[model samples]
Target: MMGFPQLSLVPLVGLQYLTHSSTLLSSPWPLASGLQQMGISQGDVVLLLLPNSIYYPIAFLGVLYLGAIVTSMNPLSSVAEIKKQIADTKACHAFTGPENADKLQALGIPAILVPENALSGSLKDIFSVFYKLIYSRCYLALRPVIKQRDTAAIMYSSGTTGVSKGVMITHRNFIATVAHFVRFEASQYEGSSLDNVYLAVLPLFHIYGLSLFVMGLLSLGSRVVVMKRFDVNEVIKAIDRYKVTHFPVVPPVLTALTKRANDSLAPHSLKSLKQVSCGAALLSMKTIEDFVQTFPHIDLIQGYGMTETTAVGTRGFNTEKLRKPSSIGLLAPNMQAKVVDWNTRSPLPPTSTGELWLHGPGIMKGYLNNAKATLSTIDEEGWLHTGDIVFFDEDGYLHLQDRLKDAIK
Candidate 1:
């Protein structure tokens, strides 16, 4: 890949403050050397419990460079929940934000807190031991020759249904997902450099943020502005300040944005935005209509995926097939999808509602350490039985019915 753009993280506190982003190429070796010295070997699982920050990406890449698995945890998770997950994953080392470090340490895990960016620009402000290693140069520390099938990440599913499960996403899974974005940008965004300013407000611990926004944007060398936390006013101001071109968000954020934009006293200044992608929870048709009516220039697209499908499975794309807010767009390239009856397990036709099953290279390796769950999720035929029930319109656009796990029989 070519050299990525010079990245700068615009802090939420002020528009003037900017933090330099250390790319995958130059920063990984030093950090990898440090990790090697710390006894982090290949295939060892490490937990990155952090909020959205420049340091999180660097630490994640460093672990991957050494052929180790990086399992990201929620920074806001309660102590009891964090303990259960750590024990479940068997991760001995954890890198966390300053806010969550103390709690993690109390649980007997080797937790390192990410340091503040002091004015001196010296290593004194950064994470003490971690920054020291970033300066260390060791040729032997580079161990990038990792098998594709090896587990690269253990992503925890958003437990909207019942219980949280750790999903094992492999290196090939990430590579395939990124490759799709690269190809899509090159072909669709022909005149443009495919490099635009990205608002990194989405939590990186989640697969939606990690696989697509973080990994995808970095691959293109786009500038990302990190928000410590999301506030409706702060987001609007950021868009106006950074001229954010693309925003991948959840449904709630969109709903809030629409409400704010409708306020006549404070008009929205989101002219630079080309598109806004939403998923996680189903967005109401009314919200989509209101947002579109308010900002006719912006393309509001919808998508559907899970922690199991890397990040993307079906997403709305360019051309005349646009503006279907109710639909989850189309199946991704090289992706096979089928809709089957809930009880009888018989295939359903287009326009008939049934469970959405998908087979693709983007499917996760499996649920980490849970073979029964994995087998039940992905059958012997390799099709992942997504609990979501959906149907297609006459135009072949997929629309949701409801999630079988949560739907009343």
Candidate 2:
């Protein structure tokens, strides 16, 4: 790790306007000190219910530095869902926005209320004073070291099928996915200033918006504009206001963007956008074509992956490739993929539809607190059973059919 670029230093590189909590700069020391004061320690699960507020980054990284596993819940989660997640993870402490703070506390769980105006005068002043003391020691020779396979975050999927299960994303898995994305950017945005602002309207709780897009962008030094929730009009307004260049979204968002273009609520100067990436759900060929026709100059690419696979397993969609828009491109570099029979686990030949199995560092450790589920998902050799039915073409491009789990018997 000596010569590797420090991911923490990336955001400070080229930022005319990067706005996170005042405490974001309080990392490596103030964070340690604050958590020490709060009594959070390694291996503890901390439930976080913060909005897209600046406080979110501060609280999240603070917990991470303490060796505690952070579980971020959807801000819009119902009271029942919130209660279930807290119980499931058995979190010792919680940090949340005012909206969900009292409700969570009512469950007899301890919590710290992140003030509505946490960025205001008094808090900002306090953070500034602490920031100076922490930085003065040059981080006081902080010897923080995170192991590659240590559990970093316990993420839960949307559970469209059933109760959400915690997905265990290790530091190694995340770093590998980051490495994969860096390889994908080889010539696409090469030599371009990473100072460009990124508009992030996607929910950070989701794998697509959280690990793949936000962390990846921050690791490379780009300003992030986070929207608390997805509002089609607000998203457009933010893009224009912030002059965002790269936009990452889901299918529903892509639809709204096309419908809202050139409208009064839409950004007047959205022509500044360089490219947009869509994931989380299958994007239709008509939607892709319509988007290209509407924006004309913008490059739109569809990426595919599941939470178990650490966000994106593949990314490849160019003009020639769009002839078969169903394909999610090729497996990412360092990723070895094969189609296997769902029943016998026997390897299937290419162009034969079967379950997609992935072997890569980006695959999760397993489902948290569920050994049976873990065994069902990850084999002895560490291949992840994606539960998604897909096949490879003669060109080696992967085309997804439907989810084996989602398919009705």
Candidate 3:
């Protein structure tokens, strides 16, 4: 979809082995056919309640290919949370790990067990739904005509501010995200993007991870090394073993990496890493400095976005002439933003701290089934009101100050 020719090698590396892009892209067809056979149609909601695995991208694309909607949840979520989401979205089916299958089954939802890794041992049942779906020879015919505005996914907000709401993202939102978010960031650096290898430690369920690993980076044909979860030890080994150049992480992971870098006997394991992109949460100034000082050669960039915005907003960029480690850099291309005064609801000028509001194609369609919450977040003019209090400096760099929402006690 990103203009790379369908060929022998495309862009996924899993568990120390290379999986051809053609294989990854083509595997979804059978899955789409299977979903169609199971009465799944366009607009039907399917939940992906699993961790980062090679199969994740396949299942996600498969559901979309069939014109069905995808809603993902953290695999570690309690049954009550899972049941609530299922009810909210009316999810007809779910793809999850074998360990979590019973939870879905107990709720009267069919769960297709996906393996934790590329290895087949994890899926001991050769006749499992995942096995049958992926290996099926029947190809999908008469694919549903998907519109750009059609809802592609429903990602739940973190609920730090309040109760979690399903953020509805459209196909156009994802297309714009890949174009403005992933591709533009790749172009800023000097290298063939196809040569870039990313270490995927962030959970694919999160917008920060999903936008990059599952959708965006693949468009550029960048090789992604998938990890089921983040582990400093395994992350180091993967970077060395796979020659990973790009690492996308959250603040905690960055902090953990900085600490690991300080304590490791051989920091040479991370010599191949070229850049580390941090997001999901704000990074303390101290954390930013520690990472930059520890990995002097690696570019440490912080981004600002939310699930409501489909992870498109401002991104940190460092050049030879300009570098703002603490600032979240500039607004994304084609994205218009405003720093609005909370009390007056008026747009503030530069250097004034207020809530950040963003208007862009990447903004969510709305909170699914919650017109009241959607209207409150997005105004009549269409700017998605990000509750983060931030200010644009004189140089146009966005600096996050605080949040309007009460802190989670």
Best model per lDDT: 3
TM-score of each: 0.92, 0.84, 0.93
Clashing pairs in 2: none
Alpha-carbon shift of residue 377 in model 2 (angstroms)? 0.9
Identify the runs in model 3 with alpha carbons over 4 angstroms from their true place.
Answer: 1-15, 120-127, 158-161, 406-409
Ranking of all predicted structures according to lDDT, beginning with the best and ending with the worst: 3, 1, 2
> lDDT per model, in order?
0.76, 0.69, 0.84
Candidate 2 lDDT for residue 66: 69
Model 3 TM-score is 0.93
lDDT of 3 by residue, 381-403 (tens): 99888888899999899998777
lDDT of 1 by residue, 281-396 (tens): 78777888888888888877787777888865778754654457778887777778999998999998889999889898888888877887888889999999888889987777
- Answer with 1 or 3, whichever has the higher TM-score: 3
Best model number under TM-score: 3
